[model samples]
Target: MVHGYSGKILWVNLSNGEVKKQSLDMELAYNFLGGEGIASNILFKEVGPETDPLGPENILIFMTGAFVGTNIPCGIKTTVVSKSPLTGIYGESIFSAPLGLDLKYSGYDGLVVKGRAENPAYIWIHNDQVEVKSAKHLWGMDTFETVDAVREELHDKSISVVAIGPAGERLVKIASIISDDSRAAGRCGLGAVMGSKNLKAIACKGTGKIAVSNPERLDELRREALNIALPNTKTLREHGTAAGLIVFEQNGNLPIRNWTRGSFPEAENITGSTMTQKILVGPNPCKTCPIACGRRVRVPSGPYAMEGSGPEYETMAALGSLCYNSNLESIAKANDICNRLGIDTISTGQTIAFAMECYEKGILQDTGGVDLTWGNPDAIVKMCELIGMKQGLGAILGEGVRRASQLIGKGSEKYAIHVKGLEFPEHNPRKFKSMAVAYATSNVGANHNRGSPMLVERNLLSPELPWKEPVDGFLTKDKGRMAKVYQDLCCAVDSLGMCKFMVFWGKLPLKILTEYYGAVTGRALTFEEFMRIGERIWNIQRAFNNRMGITRKDDTLPERFLKESVNEGPAKGQIVELDVMLEEYYRERGLDEDGKPNEGKLRELGLGWVADIIHKK
Candidate 1:
């Protein structure tokens, strides 16, 4: 049995009702680490470019990292990797709670599901017991309702359940996978893939535990990590990610009016402090989460008065200032709706904002009598409901901003804020120049979590890296190197199954993480080796998309960021100078000017086969 791993992988091929467990390969485990790393490796090897994302051939993998189910703090993350129904490229979304821990406990390091079910179905795992149960009764249920129903049927309140709602069941492209009722495997439209498979939920309960090589040293390291992280993460504990709401607005990092405006004057009304003052009931945290950055709240009584999880910073901005809405209660309502309905708030908010802008421009003549007006709180909340249910105009927006604008044609594509096909998150790229490259080059398309430019630009440099100080966001110099370094760092932390917050916000050093890997696996993962693993993992994902024809032309920011500049605020007159940065970025990544990794780069990373595939083709 492998140390720090369950030593098994659960494979369910719904096409034939075959359920088998394979021994976790040491080569795959150690090389990729886990989570995104192993999952992407498996995906690149198994899933083909000709495979339709919504078809049975596309595999959905739920995987955890090496440190999860161990003594490591914030080891609660789970990465869901599949070919995206949204981006049609390298697709991944991460959700945290005890889901990954529960997955590990079920005696599997990963769960790989493929093929469409004959009928509506859900997978239930109990220790070594596994079954694909009929989900006929759960088909149309919302994520929250499905979770409750699964728990009730299993008679195990302790089990973790991840499910989709009306949005996913209807194959809404912006759908998300919701867990713990409110938390989500948000982004990349993986929920739509679940919907296409007629799968509703996955429930798990485990009685086993992972074995670590050096338990005593691991405990000491965990204590040290908590001591260093707790103080810096205090703000997250208090306000969750909402702490950045007002600050981002002031710094011109907040996108308003569908990225048409630089600053939102009404930002303070929905800031983190306001949420804490009015609605924040307590911190909602996952198992072993030292930061406790999750928000739990409730609206005592009113029209928009119900909530289980309050809006985090991204949600707050997406549903708030982006649509000119400052009503905290309404934002919370929309958030709960998105959570229950299993739709990504970032995409939902951006889509709604795009529709509103189109309506303002008269490009959209009608919205089924639903008012697509700016700053209308009632309208914003209604649009969220509409999008989730895919009713009337919601059907168009539910296709995501890219397709929605195309369907709504008449030059509306320019108003759709996206890259490739995935909608942009709440952050503004104009303010942080590195984000221009980060957003452009992200495999999942405009993903902030995958690239982590916001945290890096804030001077959160890894002490293990040579770069000691922050690079200026306005300048193009070193921005390429900055993007490369952070992308690699994010890959390492994500594959380790530890939260990026631990490294970026908590200031946890890379050298410490190297020690954690050695303590758990009895393997010395040196700093150089750790980063190399990250680089190798990154190349794997990039290669996956490259096989599907993504190149430098596709690696670009939205035209708005390049053509238009906000006239007022800290980022005033700042248009992203992408050419110089792109040239520099390509050089730093060892990618060609066409943006594909050269054969030399892939061969050097021990991916000679990937090089053969790319270059030979």
Candidate 2:
């Protein structure tokens, strides 16, 4: 039984319905920390290289950090770790709380699901008890309906659920796992992996309490952490992340017309200010998050009139400027569909935009006479449905940009903008060189969550902040250090279960984090040790992907990004000079010829336990 403000990790093998509980590994916990860090270590040992991403042999881990269920500011994030069907590498997705807190109350610090169910099923966890209940009745239902029905059947309105919709059930490579209504484990096709196991959802409820190692110190540190996070919260509430849209537009980093152009024709029509004045209902926040960047909105007279969660900057750009659709109503609708269907809004929007460009270029005939054109809200909504339902052209597009372009070849691959099979977010690399490097070396392909250096380049690099500004976004040399520093810091923040947004608003430093960790675990450590743990976790994740056949060659941008220049904006006539960035990045990362992790660096970081892990064939 779990005691002392902690929960047990339950390992369930669906193949035989064998359930067992392992006492939380204190050694691993003290060394690697929790959430993504612990999950990374577990995946490295349990998942083999030959395990197909979509196969039953793969392991799916649902993990929460030590800080989760605490009152720590922005401490609500949970990590979902699995092998990605989209990138074929280490797949990690973060979602906010209410879910994490519920899972903790359910008496589990983490849940490891291995093997596959013989038939469709869902898992129900109530405190110490676990059940592998058949979900045949819930099969084929959309994500929202399934959650509602499960909650109703359990007769618990407050039970937290993480589930997939038709998109996952159909095995779309970019399908997402939706949680807490709007939050998602959005990238890396974790939803597809869940579907492959014939699993639908996991509903959890527990009446247990999470204990802090030092409650008095933890309370004191949480108070200090809030002081650190207040500034971040204010900025987010005022401008939202969409505030950067203006900056991006000014710098010519806004992707317009499928990236053929750098500036949008109707940027002002759908910017943050416009959204705030027109339809912004209120702010939405994750559990324990002080920065309420999430928006709740309702459009009174547009195609999307239903009240629901509003789009973030990525969602706005993917469905808005990238496709040249300035209709706020349509963008709102697309956000709703993406959330309800459990798809990555960024990739989904980008994929549909690529299809539209292909249709415009006569590379693909419109299926069922659907038109693929710029600035058409109707087509955008229709395509979203088709993608979710896996109908017609949606089938081809749902395979992700890499495979989608491969299937519909004719130099179409040139325009399928992505890296290592994953699609890019809304940011334009031409305007931000650091952004370019971040996308190039991200473990899970082109995701920004890995470490977005653009925040440093644009927000903090001015004369006022501690950092010095380099050249404009188009420059490419000396970027390796930028990405490396941020990646380490990001790993630390993620391990601590803190949101990256807090870095911008609050002066969250290593000291603050040390205090937080010290307060929670009662295990005091120097700042250097905390940072080393972050690096260790990062290298372990890199090693996991390295074993999965990912190499330096896989760390590359799409052909269009390397070859084509943006046609308009201040960043006009520029392409990502990735070669210089890649070389410097590898050097800074201590990698040898083939982008493998340097053995010496691993040893230096006290990761000698698995030196051979880095050099695996």
Who wins the TM-score comparison?
Answer: 1
Compose the digit string of candidate 1's lDDT tens values, residues 1-617: 47888898899988888999999998888888999999998999998889999999999999999989996988878899999998899999988857788889889999999999999999998988989999999888889899999999999888899999999999999999998677899899999998888889999999889999999999999888888888988888888888988889888899888888887888999999899999989988877887888888899898898969888999998999999999999999999999999999999998999999999999997888887789899998999999999998999999999999999999999999999899999888888888888888988998898777556567877777766777666777777777887788788789888888776789887788999999999998888988888899999999999888898899888789999998788888989999888888899899986678888889998999888887884
Candidate 2 residue runs with Cα over 4 Å from true position: 1-7, 461-472, 614-617
Model 1: clashing residue pairs? none
Tens-digit lDDT track of model 2 for 358-454? 8888898856668787788888888888888788888888889889999999989977988888888887787787878888888888887887677
Instruction: Tell me the deviation in Å of residue 126 in model 2.
Output: 1.5
Q: TM-score of every model?
A: 0.99, 0.95
What are the per-model numbers of colliding residue pairs?
0, 3
Cα deviation at 529, candidate 2, in Å, is 2.1
